[model samples]
Target: MLFDLTDLRLFIHIAESGSLTRAAERMHLSLGAASNRVKELESRFGMRLLYRENKGVQLSPAGEALLIHAQQFMQQLERMKSDMQQFSSGIKGHIRIFANTTAVTEFMPQVLGSFLARHPQVNVALEERLNADIVRGVAEGTADIGIAAGPVQGQGLEIINFSTDRLVLVTPREHALAGSGRIAFADTLAYAHVGLHEGSSLWHFLSRIVSQSGQRLELRIRVRSFEAMCLMIEADVGIGILPQSAALRHSQTMGLALVELDDPWAVRERSIVVQSLDALPHYARELVEEIRAGQAPRAISPDRNA
Candidate 1:
């Protein structure tokens, strides 16, 4: 009770930055004011919390103990606010979702529009991230929900199967491998590829596969959208791997051939991931239901491993 939220926050900043000057700047307080606050905290507790050094400050045993409690308190405060948001019409509820490229580019727009229309007071932040990053974000409570594809270990989390899709190789109509019918992903690495931008989840997935195969992708160009990649392929820039849904849609207008990938990993089961559905606020839960409602019809794959 001796230190207020502002004092605790300032202490956290100083502990993290290891500099009172930097902490003062972060807390928007003068150096003297920040020093007095720390002094008062120590005076109330009758213990030295930090050891001052020429360069910066180091936490004493007491300071470390306080830091742990302070961090937990801040996290609980955030959770409390989120839980209380649905009851307050004046406050806007916020949801953060991390998803794979396929979900972000192919499915989310339509579902999100409907969800936003229903919840006008709610805000959504959707970001594309790799499977690992998405899982980590959800686990760490950084993301309210995660949309991931393929097999996932549900350690301390809930996984809901939402849809299914396949990754297929796209090539120009006249390309040499266009008539192959189906090809292994490793074989495709022999040809030049039109890949997604490095930051895209699909790009990260493909790069990991290539690394595991001990081969490298001969990337001719990088694009941000499936349409762009298809256009590039039509222009004979290079071949590419794309979600079958996207490739099929583009093949109608572009000179692109969709060839099935002979790899088990190509057949992906898109899933909704969260720490716990019941723990989410009403608005966040509603968004999850919206995504589930937009599920694609399940596709049968020949590969048992799919």
Candidate 2:
């Protein structure tokens, strides 16, 4: 049998508060009105939903069953309302984004800050993962969008060029190479380097540069995160290569210095990956557009030196 939503709300409130008077106060209704509403609902269903006990109200067997269904129904209704508001307003839904550590720490703050300020109603959640994992999250629908450096190869996903970041060499302030504003590919390879673990996007990018230059880099240590690599460099364990933004952001606190990599291949493009551009929820699409447009002014020139 169909039940009125208002009656269900009153029943749930009474069940939650364990007192009819408390529920009436919460609902801004007189106690008599609340009692009459409950009585009418019970009469229609021909079953008592609550039993008065010494301490509080208790739900009967049928009340328990109806309560479960009512809660589920209310949750579904709330979800529907949220979805509809997002569709109509272009800004009122949860967007789950997966990004690499570099993007998460360096780039996303400005983009997200602006998006949130403009939308106000949108809620955003960010997950940090490696580049590959970010791509996987977007493909699997676990994340609404993925942002990272370099291209992601997968079917059924649209990759958009968002921005570009140069990979630079970082060294401790005391290192001989610290004063060099820009170092050639051969010079960087000559130093012992701290690098991301093999198979990471940064590692793969560095490998390509080494291969194209006909040399192999001497890696002193392999670590999982940019922060770890920076810590190692600061301790003078080894020099390292990382995104320029990461180097600049941590340079002061980490006691590290950054030098531009003169290698032509050191530049990398940051891209936004989505499962389907057209299929994204309204809020997600809006976020993607903001990121894309926000990078227009910072678009890397084809001339690497520029």
The worst-scoring run of ten residues by lDDT in candidate 2 lies at 297-306
Quote each prediction's TM-score: 0.77, 0.56
Which candidate ranks first by lDDT, i.e. highest? 1
C-alpha RMSD of each candidate structure in angstroms: 5.1, 12.0
**CA error at residue 79 for candidate 2, angstroms:** 14
Q: Could you give me the TM-score of model 2 versus the true structure?
A: 0.56
Clashing pairs in 2: none
On a 0 to 100 scale, what is the lDDT of residue 125 in model 2?
A: 78
lDDT of candidates 1 onward, in order: 0.87, 0.79
Q: Which candidate has the top score in TM-score? A: 1
